[model samples]
Target: MIRKIGVLSISLLCLAAITSCEKDFSEVGTNVVNNDKFETGEILLDVEITPKNIESVQADNINASISDYWLGVYNNPNAEKIEASIISQLGYISNLNNKDTDTTVFNLDKVILKIPYQATSTGTTDGVTRFKLDSILGNPDVATSIQVLENETYLNTLNPSDPSKRNTFFSDDEYLGDNVLSEGGIYQLKPKATDTTFIFDRVDRSSSLTGTTTYKDTIRAINSQKLKVPFLAIPLDITKMKTLFWDKFHSGEFLSKEAFDDYFRGIKIVATGSDGLLIPLNLASSPAPSVDFHYTISEVDGTTVKDTLQKKYSFPLAGVRNSHYKMTPATNSAPANNFVVQGTAGKMAKVKILGLDLSKSELTQQFKGDFNDNLNDYDIDDNGFLSLDELQKLFNYRKNILKSNSYLLMNDASLTFYINQAINNDSNIIPQQLFLYQNKENETGGISPTQLTDAYVDPTSFGGTLKKTDDNPEKYTFRITDYISKLLSGEENTTTDPLILKVYNPTDSPVNNNVLTTSVKSYNWNPRSVTLFNGNESANGTKRAVLKISYSKEK
Candidate 1:
């Protein structure tokens, strides 16, 4: 009886397998499988941000070598009314010749101070080329009053208190007193035609074949072309030039460069107007900014002219070029809970990360608050309580986690700032990028802004470029993985300094020796403004600024 029962069971099993193969397979158990068992998730946290009005920035040592000096007055509706000026010292004339030892009489024809405009040729029309000034901020049609004043203050290259460091000058320095040398009158951003046409010498090369004899003929011709290059031609006072420079031609003051610098300090170019534009003047360009002394020298022997010659002595504007800025804060024009960001001694925003310094108990409470419903799912010990030690073991993973037994890792940490579209709708005036830095206390108990360590590690990944949707700038995103990781891992100070958000200045150094650094000297020449939503929950709601961090943790 037992053998018969075993054979019957084997036959039934074979029949069942054969019947199932004949029919179509069914997905009845597919829904029972857990697809999200090992999936990772992210946590979004809100960050606090506030507006900070900048009074001034270090503007000394901002010469032609590092960056172009700005000059003019501009009224920004969002931030401040800025008036930019330049104070520059003239370089000395090397190798002075004693030609005036004889009876040589010097007669000043005219003294002119020329500052070439940064212009580009648009097109040639009717034998004349049209040009437009480059890097002109605000309305170019408005006229401004320009004045060149004698700077009585001596500009030192090194700090008087500490010779090791370079001298620092703020934007609000009063370098020009009542010493007006040349009042340049009302001036607009228009190209000025030359008073006289320039004569150009051209050579034409032509080849002619006649009776198997080749003849190459070269003809030299003179062509007249009226050249027009945009520049500021301020007619300086000839009498003043004679007294300041010409009279001391062969005197002891001209014997040394330092002596001449002490005698004639420098010139300050100031701009004043109700409505005007700001322009960047390139003092290092060809035919740089200079005071040209055009004169004629006649060798007079008892009123009998022996020899006569026309000459020009150009005193180039060089050495210790500083920018002075006077800013009047704008009225409260931005929307409620909106902050402003501007360049060139403007304003910035201060940022603080929430819950960045929580204790173990506080962190456990926050974790519970963030994942109250899923706390039981993550509690692997099968206990009703979830401890901080277990959560750390589960989520605290190093950047290189292959060597450790950690079960979770942070992938990215970023801050997204939404633009206030009502105030910052104009794309032309919006800043192309933004920068995030931290202010470190200096030796003198002063704070200085410096770049984050992530920027130095990889600038491409540490993004601050403007993000747009449908070709319209909508927001700016910054990747701060290293910085956030350090804070989480207790590598950095728990009481972290507030990060500063400002308009990106291209001249600021992004990296040095594989470490991030920033320029303490003033180099932000851009005059643009942008308004962003401050992280005020009562005002902005969901659109308020927040720190979004994506991570991968065990389920």
Candidate 2:
């Protein structure tokens, strides 16, 4: 009898060899796993303390040690949106008093649902917590009731399919069936009138770098064929664009598109991804040329300064290089087309431009030369050509600077989505919205971004300390690479999550190297993560450019 009792002990029960009738998975059937196999994940909303209610846990110890409950993400179509808003609002939720009641908190235009999911060491998890999705106004407010559970079910099946295995990015779109497929998913987007358009909220890669156009009436043949333009966001309005600065001609409202023909014309407003890739912005019809504006760089310095040689990886190369060139950050308010100097004598330059047609003669002449003080005053005439007086000034600049035709056309310029995969990586590689977002004030909730000045480790943040359970990371590694590269190439007819990272080299000036970067970094992930939002990762290797990814499902 004593031996039989010992066999049934809670600790020894699983190993007891008594019943042949028991299922092989009985061990896992009894507990929620803390690994990457499940799609559903969970987060502990109240990290303060265990309630006087749950007796088994060190409620007081756990609660007392937590500054605020750190959140994990899963099953969210918009983590970037949520993360930014959380950072700004400092989403601090607490049931300090453990009230059963609720109240409205903050209202915002960009608050998405607060799903219950997060990745942990053992597996993705959730605390038996629930909160209302949102208020009638779309923004969430109020502290609501929560049910913190030590155990919850995680049932998410992840299909680590290959991109090369499929015919196109869309074969699995409608077939994905509740899996929450994203850009890096097996499925591609299909064209539809309802497809959302994106606006270039910001493009750090966008430059005032333009070569003179050699316009010919022959080139004026309009592209009558309708195009599907996608933007990073949605319908662009003058209100949102007004925030960016473009060089003013000291002119009027100029609302009438008809009056803007002479020097700048035949340009259309199309949607682009946050990185400035042309996305399907207007589905109803293709975009048409409207108006042209001046272009300018912000910083005036002639060169990029290196902060510290050894710290290249410690700080983003984008910041270092851009800071080196004393150029300004170009904005929607800047002139639509303009030429800016990149390098001084004996030095190379990094100049960028957008919105000018290199096919136009007026531009070609201006760009064909080394544009400088002498290049200025190139008079513009109707029908688009230099006033001839300006041609003389350009004659000198073009001679010295433009030796190798000194001009290259960015005809291939268009919006594209980009992706980089790692054996281990974080979802923060997804482009987050910096313009509009907010946090929830309540403790009990759905998806709310959790802020951290010293944020917890993510796939990108993870050093070599974590284990290598990179099963899922390996699966998505290849797909994510193709997924992002395709987006950067502007491939259409595929479904993508709203989240994307707007990347660019911080150099407002020109770079000696072609790799452009941005401060924003994030990624799209495997659907199985029910609770993990983004991974705690940090890129590694002797070359800072070498990317590395890692994760911690638990302590």
- Expressed as tens digits, the lDDT of each residue in 132-215 for candidate 1 is 777677666776667888898889887889988777777777774566778343334333323212121211111111113322
The candidate maximizing lDDT is 1
lDDT of 2 by residue, 1-555 (tens): 000111111111111121212323222321233344322221110001010110011111111121111111111222111110011001111111211112211111111111111111222226321222110110122211111111111111222264333111110111111221112222121222222232222212112112232222111101233222221111222222222111122233222223222212111111111211011111111232111111223221223321211100000001000000011222222111111111100011111111111224535443443343442355555534442224333333343342321121101111111122321154332212111011223347443322211112121221111121342221111012222222222334211222211111112111126543222211111111111112211221111111111111111
Candidate 1 shows a clash count of 0
TM-score, prediction 2: 0.15
Task: Provide the overall lDDT of each model, using Cα atoms, as 2-decimal numbers.
Answer: 0.64, 0.19
Best by TM-score: 1
Q: How many clashes (backbone N, Cα, C below 3 Å) per candidate?
A: 0, 143
TM-score, every prediction: 0.74, 0.15
lDDT of 1 at 288: 70
How many clashing residue pairs are found in candidate 2?
143
